[model samples]
Target: MANIPLEDIQNDVDTIVSEWIDLGLLKRGELFVIGCSTSEVAGERIGTSGNKQIAKELFTSFRKLEEKTGVSLAFQCCEHLNRALVVSEDVLERFRLTEVSAIPVPGAGGSMAAYAFQQMQDAVLVESIQAHAGMDIGDTFIGMHLKPVVVPIRLRQKNIGAAHVTFARTRPKLIGGERAVYSKDQAKSMLCD
Candidate 1:
């Protein structure tokens, strides 16, 4: 496998996060989940070649994103931990999430998640969360952590290092059938009592 420069990894993350910011879907303080596989980023199969240095670069970019957007972050662990997430204690209390017991290691939780658990001031593991938005780097599968009615976001920057990337934003489910008026203008025209 080819060696992916750490600088490239950081640049890709920054670019992707910038696109996410431009979308304007994620609000301040909203939960954003991230699922990444450092091994995949390094041009290897997921869980085969975990790299701490790659995780560090990705983590740095994500921290910058948090500072710029004020969005809370959740780092999803690998399937070994049943895809639980690493989040700050504040996020846990704010969302009333149930705490889970585990300390993520590179082999078990994944390099990205394990790094996040260590860097966070008060990191805690949670069984689950319904995040408002999310990015999946290296096909780690963040869908289970996102809220219902997820809208896939297509970004110009599609890859982080050697891994494919996907993004999503959640919105309230549109209910009602044909009779439903979705906009204020339509409601005014209908004039229902």
Candidate 2:
């Protein structure tokens, strides 16, 4: 933590999310899976300590990402539910996603996800998903939350605190074999190109 002030964290988040958008890592209405480890932000093991302050900082940045990209967020829970995500009502309707019933707590949902749930206007827990893009903070394990094809994204900043971060966006799973010629442009378009 370097005993760094919380402001630095907030600023870092804003910078990262914006950079993610600018780098064509995400787009409007696409699902943005976030698997945050608040403990790591507080200089602890992945799930050892869920700090509200860190969650709030991350949430502020996430909201900015939401506003700028119009990307729907899915807060990935911990190993519980195999890291099933919670999405907004708009996301549920857009993707016809099923809304399970579960409210995130600091311990159960991890602080970052719980904070997102608190800030979101309309939120619902979903048992499964195929998200368009995702950021796994502290390696909360968001692979289960992504779509059929996941493309890794390398961010300018590798780790966002003590947590190791990973980002990826999905592509339409290529089904056809030798005869199939997938659109290269379509793949690039997935990242908001």
Candidate 3:
């Protein structure tokens, strides 16, 4: 957008992440995935135009989230790279994810992912991951990186710039019949069953 305010975009990110923290959907020592399309944010077709300014705004917000929550962030690349992700080596080691070799540029990986890769400490390309929660900016389709049992979240700030936003968090899959009770009190019984 010609008049896109970086603060507003950053605020949108802050609000969604705050909601996740408030709901306990995201916690410390977890992974958060982000899929952003800077072109869509600028009111252009996806992948046609990548904006580093927009990416910088979004990435800064994500960094704030990480600093506050102690959660790791992963950036998902565009389809040119088959939507592979960039994450810190610590996250790779923790999750046992396989590392791939490739340097992301704006054309291939999209602006946001490429910017994130540059910003991350010990960044590495990974084939896949099972994140605990995530945000999809501009319909970038981040769901593929989230853990199974994703529950969609509706946030107050539904869009960042012109891009549609989607938020989600994962939970442990429920695997029992009608007779099964699911609660903290039943945790031991379920685990011992």
Best by TM-score: 1
Worst window of 10 by summed lDDT in candidate 3: 17-26
Best lDDT among the predictions, by candidate number: 1
Task: Give the candidates in order of TM-score, highest first.
Answer: 1, 3, 2
TM-score on alpha carbons, each prediction: 0.95, 0.86, 0.91
RMSD (Cα, Å) for all candidates, in order, is 1.7, 4.9, 2.7
Q: Given candidate 1, what's the lDDT at residue 169?
A: 89
Where's the lowest-lDDT run of ten residues in candidate 1? 184-193
Candidate 3: residue 111 Cα off by (Å): 0.3
lDDT value, residue 143 of candidate 1: 96
Estimate every model's Cα lDDT from 0 to 1.
Answer: 0.93, 0.79, 0.87
Error of 1 at 92 (Å): 0.6
Stretches of candidate 3 off by over 4 Å are 186-193
| Prediction-by-prediction clash tally | 0, 0, 0
Q: Per-residue lDDT tens digits of candidate 1, residues 85-110? A: 99999999999999999999999999
Which 10-residue window in model 2 sums to the lowest lDDT? 1-10
